[model samples]
Target chain A: MDKLGVAEGLINRRKLLGLASGAAAAGIGLALPELVMAAPFEGLVERARQAGERQVVVAGGTGAYGDLVKKHFYLPFTEATGIEVVPTGGGYGEKLAKLKAMTSVGKVEWDVITLSIDSLTPDVTSLLRDLGDCAGLPDVASQGVDGSCLREGVMFDIGGGVLAFDKRSFPEGQAQPAGWADFWNVKAFPGPRALPNIGNPWWALIAALEADGVSRDALFPLDIDRAFRKLDEIKPHVTVWWKSGDQSQQIFRTGEVVMAMLFSGRAFRLRGEGIPLGISWNGAPLDAAFWAVTKAAQHPNAALALLDFIYTRPKAHAEFAAESFGSTAQRGALDFLTADAKASSVLQPANWSNIVRVDREWLAANREKVLQRWSMWIAS
Target chain B: MRAKPLAGSPFGGRPTSAQEYGPGLSLLLVTPLVLLLVGGFLYPVGKLFWGSVFVPEATFANYARILQEPLFLLVLCRTFEIAFVVTALALLLGYPVAMAMARVSGRTAMLIAACVLIPLWTSVLVRSYAWIVLLQRNGVVNNALIETGLTGTPLRLLYTQGAVIAAMTQVLLPFMILPIYSVVRNIPDDFVRAARNLGAGSLQAFFRVTLPLSLPGVTAGVLITFILSLGFYITPALVGGPGTLMMSTLIGQQTTELLDWPFAGALAAVLLAATLLLVIVFRRALALNKGFKLG
Candidate 1:
């Protein structure tokens, strides 16, 4: 237990960052826009109360994002309705594993889960109830951004792995890193760099291919060899191949590497600390995590009610995303954000265009092959 | 003085084999551990291997895939290589500390023991992160070197193969020390005195009489350390560079990332077999006689 606490404390710094942004979100999130369809959400709450579903158990990641979501969505939902919100979850990998294990045992424990875009992939998609055009969630269908409502789940959060650097190294007037190409340009950007060595090699691979001259839109069915070749040039210069998101920020803080590829949310968190960080959303992979109701959810009614509440309350969604440096699929979420929060969020109109869209079908099909090649190439 | 008593049965008095306790009592004594081993370890491992070969139907495709990909073999060899380095380093460093602990009386022995045991209590992640602080670009090691005019710039000390070996050795040193210390403590001073009385110098007494007797401990220590080192995942992943990939990391990617349990099981089965094979070879090679039966 002592060791577990130590491990959590070390890793929870990422969550701590989320908490910081949550506070910032709270500071300016006082002005939530009025909703015309507030009555519908109230009726759903009444229905949840009538159904005797007093609580919805949610499995999601912890830390600031967890804290912010609970504060902005879960806690408010609980207040508006009589239903209590119980939060439990782990990292994406652990969540997926738990889902697989629970479903296999025929004793699923969670009413809802926050999952990755890969949840929509074959095999995992079966664990989810096909919300079928999400016909039941009318507010979500009308207000969620295009493509947010999928057959398997709704996109709840969005962030991307973007190229981030210390602005001190490349002062504003001087040449600063603009994109993945600049991240590769060691001559112009003469400093130690960092890239992910975590299992999500596709981010680095995609960035490498982009740097190697592939256009962002056409980068799927990746040119793995070319990516490796480009990676080779930067290998000697890489000071850190960070494992966890927390470690990435720690390395930057310690001046281990002046520039590195970091999650956009994490980078914004660093920027929030006034660390003079610069982010380039250019050519970054558009990463998204989804929220889905388990097929065997004990409180399906409550879960549906909670989902509708999230979409209809755009201000809370905005604050949750703003403080967490993430993006929500709620269409009205943007209007509630401060300009600073908007600039930090990847879902912003200007930043959205620069993010390289992951071909989820290709990634799902080739995850094993891509990962094997990545491990081999990196080690060699 | 009466001859020093043999470091006899752990159960006290004369040594008696389990059969003397009778089957029922012995079974009762072992039931909990046996149940735990079977339930926690064997069942899951058995299920994993079952799921692996039977991907809906029995096939060796997972095993075949391991052979087809050079990464598995390469990582497997590298894992053994790192384990060997860590084990050797731990032995070289641990032997002296263990000898000191054995020779020292009362408070001194307690103090030395604390030095070895305190680290075991700390989490491995904390220790590895400590290494990061000491070896990073602007970390203590590099800062010290620069201040001392050893180098003009900071050396890349963190995230190298060297860092992995160093951190792992530090984490595992206690395992190497305790076994050797236990064995050395039991050896009578008379053994060394006997060698000295026979006209041997201290060095000769240590080498011929002491070291040979200590081989049982050395073998035991090496076996434990080597096997433990083989499966090391977190330390290398956190402190070692991507180039410092190991077999466990490969297995992890399969299970967590790829969700290809069968392939992960195959990789694990291969590693387990290799580890068992190595352990057997080591025991046979050491050939400790009598009570120190390695087999």
Candidate 2:
């Protein structure tokens, strides 16, 4: 949490660990002397072993993306710490329900879980433990981009709802949309376009507000009325209000929309499959998934160890992020990625600089109100 | 386990039928259904009612909120509007098919029946997605329009309210056709022939004889289509644009996205009440035509 030096941190950890001078070698700092400079907890592996913790249950997603998480993070953590990784995959709703059920009965099955702006709130906070300041997460604290570490969770990966256009419309050296304002200019960039109206409406709202000449810094505490007004202009042109990521790609592949807002990961996959797609990071609204520990976790130390292990290997992080067409918190991970791999990665300066973080905190509080308003606005 | 012999019993406890097939057997035959209804339908509905009124300390707030918000009422109105439109379209489009099926040769009737049943057999989700493929900007409909010079530019058809109505009608057409087909198929051929013989033109004979006799099936078909369309979720969500938001969409949003179970319960209850009210009105209207009461 302290952006200053390590002199006080070492003393603080020393007292926190309460390890005698003779046992200094086995303290938190020395446990991973080579990898972690300042591990969050002392003797995490030793404590987990003592606690008889072997498997860390996670509500990890399924399919190709889930496999990537397992290969890149879980397997290595198991190898390094001797804890088996069990990923019981389900959708956000299912997982949240399970979490609530587990906690209500005082027996949580999952040790760690994923969180997004959608599942982050709606009165579901008591289920997760507040990782105070995330000070123990040295990697996230030091190397992560701004707002990477928070009281509730640490961001494991980041994706964006980006402006992905067909390159044929704006070929090389041709004038291209630089931001949301450009995205809104149908006269200049004429084509049927797509925007998501999936359960998540905030992404479209952010894009609309940005197009309405609101500064990126002043976007939060959203001007709902202004956003809807801007959306009115683009509503006619959005031929497809795609409900899923697959549909988003399908619309583009079939030329349903020459220019549209699409999930960055889906856009990357389309480009990889030989589509002449161009992704502009202009005012891209970031959709990040955070790694959170449950309050009812049986093995809290084991959960922390798994989270800590994520930041240990930058190369694995890069590979996982690239394969999924997303990005990790660590800027260093981007170094290991290929040029083609970094095309949709937030590590690219164009994307990273222009990226707009979704105000998750605000969204969490006003989810129902905003959703009701959105339902009314879109339908009306 | 004997079925009670109550004269006004809706559950078919009349002594006349139960006595014919040993009372116990008649009651036994229906036990599984009774249990299923009690467990699957009634229990869940009871729970939903309880949650709507009881969650957060026995308050009517959930139901009140639904009434308070203009959004809920707007969606409810829109849902009814879509249902009415779908029912009207299905009737207009389906009556002819039903008539053909009823009057055609047996082999042709079988083929027409197959056409109606095939789409009904197909998953609603798949059918909805198929509509998207056909109506998409670069999809078959647009491509055909462009090729034939029907329009200069591809029309935005897929995500519009019109698309929703079209898809919903297509989906619900089978429901409308089968009922009318069955009744029309049973209408005596002599009735129309007799009317025509009695100084009636072909059109007059058909309208007076065929149409009046087929009214029962038409009423039944309208009831089925209207009820189903009121709760339509997938077709509207897939093909309908923002302006076409329906009641089920709002209910789904509350349950899944917001996890507002109480509010979702209220929404469901409102839909159920509205559907029941409409069905009752339809039944009362149908009742005026003596001996034409539907099950």
Candidate 3:
């Protein structure tokens, strides 16, 4: 009986040790994948390959822009480097917030993120690693990259907010609105208008000041009080304050608003769809979208490789620009763009001179205060 | 007449029953769920509350700003106002459905239940989009209205305060229905029959006995609907116009557009506090009504 008891005790102890070791194994298993995923990808291309980590995630806008990036940039990059590229779509603000949260938590998921000029502020730049020394970084200045993309990010495509109106409302032989001044002329325009309420209100504010007779050169350091007064004049007539790109498109599609401030690419798409859309590029703010590598990216090398691939291969850049109705910053890419595409592009010489470049730095600095005032104005 | 032995009592004098494992064993069984709630819900909420004071320096500045700012205050009041309207509409619409469900059985009950629940299964975005289609200027409703000669021009129905309430009520109606259905179903038919036999009309029996008994469920439904409506963002955002700014919308702007986490947290904390205070007041009022009945 005593011998039986000793055997049972030994069996119990062995069971306890087995349970403990199993738990330890589970803990290690849980932690190991995150460690491998979080490791830097720079100068570790061979190591990454050995580990079979060949996928890089890229986050950008949805719909047409996302499709263009996938078809032209991601596919070509993957074909060249044998690394798979995954594209994730979200709003510009959402992506920025996600990146900030992910970096704070030290578990970066996206390798490359497309950012707006306004999002390239100091606070955001601090979270991004300077790509100056990234392998195969392009000469953005020589390539005629927009000023917004000259630092920190690779400027991929350029589009601007243009005054687009329903052709049905302002058809052939009708006096179409030409610029911000014409847009603010309610008596002449004589229809409900829409303006973007997304992100910063800089576009609307600048346009308002311009309508109020503030010259382009003296637009910066915007007079807030004066802008509000001008906005109030048109507020009663402004029917829709569109909050998304899709919503802006919808407002026009449904004929809810006769005129709207819309992204040029969307206007181009609408025109292509035979939607009878009229686009006025005069006084439009030239906006550039840039691809930047996250500081905590797990696949930084692959991201850098993709960025280089986009710039060096002018055909892919031009293809994306043509299909998406956006302008490529790479000068070499322009050679591949068809005459029709070039005519539609804001970067074309005739349209380029009429568009205004938003002072991103000034806008970034005053973003908070301006947004506060904007919200107050909207509420009032 | 010495309280002549209660019917169905096995024991003569005092009843003897099996002892329960008590609170200790019950708590032990619930430990995993408690831990999950603590780790998941409570921890994040605690972190959010902490973030409010700590960000941009550990100060009450964020809270102070929210309290002082007229915009924040206006948004808060608007949030509550919307929630109140939504809750009242849900209760009104849902009570009839719940009554019908309680009255029916078998296939009919299942059909009613499915009607209530199928919407819950669908995505909120899809439902909101559906509302847009039905309410837009040139949408189905407006076309019908124009064809029927209701008005010469289509009414602006898509982005009005009424649209928000309608959509919210539709989305939250199920929440209000299920609770009342369960309670109304459980009420014994004998009570209403007895009331009728005692020379009471059917409606009088319903008002005196059925409605009073169903107050618990009504209270639960109202509380649930009101709280859920307060945090509603998408429905209001899609269906309502810029004029229909709610607390959650402001919080979203602060978090995403402005990257003002501290201020967002502060706004959330204020909202949470208000909800809790309202809940307490509601419960107190309920308890007082019950006390009056007992007295």
lDDT of 3 by residue, A148-208 (tens): 3445778777778899988788887989888888889988887778898876588898889
Question: Which residue segments of model 2 deviate by more than 4 Å?
Answer: A1-59, A81-89, A92-111, A117-137, A141-143, A293-305, B1-25, B286-295
> How do the residues A1-380 of candidate 2 rate in per-residue lDDT, one tens digit apiece?
32233222433443444343235456534344432344543456556655788889999778988998888888766655557999887887778778888888888889999867456663666678888887776667766767777677788777788899998878879988777888899999898888887767888889999999999999999888888889899987877778788888888788888888888888888987889888888898887788889998988889987776676667887878767877777777878888777666787666787888777788877767777777777777
Off by over 4 Å in 3: A1-115, A119-156, A186-191, A290-318, A330-343, B1-20, B55-57, B256-259, B291-295
Write down the TM-score of model 3's second chain. 0.90
Stretch of 10 with least lDDT, candidate 1 chain A: A1-10
What is the per-residue lDDT of model 3 for residues B78-145, given as tens digits with 9 covering 90 to 100? Answer: 89999999999999999989989998899999999999999999999999989999998788888999
For residues B213-266, could you state the per-residue lDDT of candidate 2 as single tens digits?
788899989999999999999999889877888988878878876778888999
Classify candidate 2 by CAPRI docking class.
medium
**Angstrom error at residue B173, model 3:** 0.5
lDDT winner, 2 or 3: 2
Scanning candidate 3 chain A in windows of ten residues, the lowest lDDT window is: A1-10
Per-prediction DockQ comes to 0.54, 0.53, 0.34
What TM-score does each of the candidates earn?
0.77, 0.84, 0.75
Could you give candidate 1's per-residue lDDT for residues B97-169 as a string of tens digits?
9899999889998899999999999999899999988999999999999999999988988889999999999
Ranking by DockQ: 1, 2, 3
